[model samples]
Target: MSRFQSKTLCRVGILAAMYVPLALFVGIQFGNVRLSFGSLPVVVGALLYGPLEAALVALVGELLKQLLTYGLTATTVLYLIPPMLRGLVIGAGAVWMWRRGKRLENCRTRCFAVCILAAVCTTIGNTLVNWLDSVLYGYYTFAYVFGDAVYRFGVGMLNAVVVATVAIPLVVLLRRQRVVQEVKRP
Candidate 1:
């Protein structure tokens, strides 16, 4: 592989390693609240490397978390798919927006815009996945799932907003550090 490809693979591996423990700790502690810095890695990996890398990181991270913590419950595994999809969709959207001159390099406005976009995209993706899961499991009617969808959307929106506001800035700060830069480049 070329330098870029090697770097990308390394990044994906590192992200998966870092995110698994962190996400599991947060997931176990926070559960549905999900008030952790897990998404930051996905966003940063996406911005620095690429969406595919970010998606890989997100998926592997969640899988590892589930394996370690819950020993792979069917429900948990099923729920993991949505966040994986959400990370992929949000990362792709963020990268696309950045490449199209969104300029989230240092501008606060650009960063906030990117965050908002991520929030919306992830929220929609997550809601859709939950709705599908509800349908598949036959836990609730379409109307009930629809109501739950609204609740999930609202919570997801809040989570995204909080993550964007807090986690993105922290990721940016970490990115500026020499350690993070070396990791990104290597």
Candidate 2:
């Protein structure tokens, strides 16, 4: 691997390590809804590095966490969807905006846009997945699932707010600190 890739992977590894405890312990869960701080690292990695870094952190990290904590199960696969979507969508969106000159360093609106896009994508993807899992398991009727969807939607809004609030400043801070380096597009 090239030096840049190597550095990114190392950073991803570190982010993955940070993600587990924050996800399991720092996150808040109410019934089927969960607000996870774990995604913060993924978003940070994505905005700083790129989608690959974010995906590695989200996918590999969460996989390891699931394997270690709950072991293998059919349901374990379902857990991967949300984080992966968050990382990919957020990373790609931010990177796209940056490459298009909607730079995060000066534009708070662009930063907010990235956060909102990520949150919307994550919320929709996870909510669908949750609904599917319930249907597949015969856990609830369509009416009940609709009720659950409403609850999940509320939780998703909360999650979006938290992610945007935390990520934008952290991104700016990382840039100011020189901890986040912008990747050059070829």
Candidate 3:
């Protein structure tokens, strides 16, 4: 592998390793929402790398989370959608900004906006997944799923702001330290 590829994979592996514990243990519970800074590393990956790598981080991290938490139930794969969506969205946004000559480190407002958008998308995807899981496993009523979505959306957005707030400086530091190089998406 090329140096960039190896370095990227190493960073992705480290971030994915960081994600599981963050999601499983470091989260702040907002009732049923379970808000967490787990998204921090994934968003950082997105801003630093690109969509595919960040999505890999989300997928592997969430997959491990499911395996450890629920032991691979029927909804295991379904549950991974939200985090992957978050990664993909932020990554695409980073690419878009890069094309416009605006680095995520330099465009704080735009960076936060993209993060919020990704969070909203993740929240929506998560609600749909919950609805599907409820239907498939009879875990909860369909009505409850819809009702809880509003709360989830609010907490998710808040978590996005927190993740973005933290990720910006973190990415800046990574760039300054040359731990992660700036990526311009094609």
The candidate that wins on TM-score is 3
Q: Rate the local accuracy (lDDT) of all candidates.
A: 0.63, 0.76, 0.87
Candidate 3 Cα misplacement greater than 4 A, ranges: 1-4
Candidate 2 per-residue C-alpha lDDT over 15-88 given as tens digits, one digit per residue, 9 for 90 to 100: 99988987888878899778878787887887777677788898878898889888997777887877788788
TM-score, cand. 1 = 0.70
Worst 10 residues of 2 by lDDT: 103-112
By TM-score rank, best first, the candidates go 3, 2, 1
lDDT of 1 at 113: 61
- The residue ranges of model 2 lying beyond 4 angstroms of the native Cα positions read 135-140
36-137, model 1: which lDDT tens digit per residue? 667767767665555677778888887777788768655666656655665566556556666575534356566556656666666666666667767677
Per-residue lDDT of model 3, residues 1-186, tens digit only: 998788778888999999999989997777777878888879988988878889989998999989998897888999899999999999998888888877865799888898999999999998888888888877778668898777788888899998898899998888889976655468
**Which is better, 2 or 3, measured by lDDT?**
3
Per-candidate TM equals 0.70, 0.84, 0.93
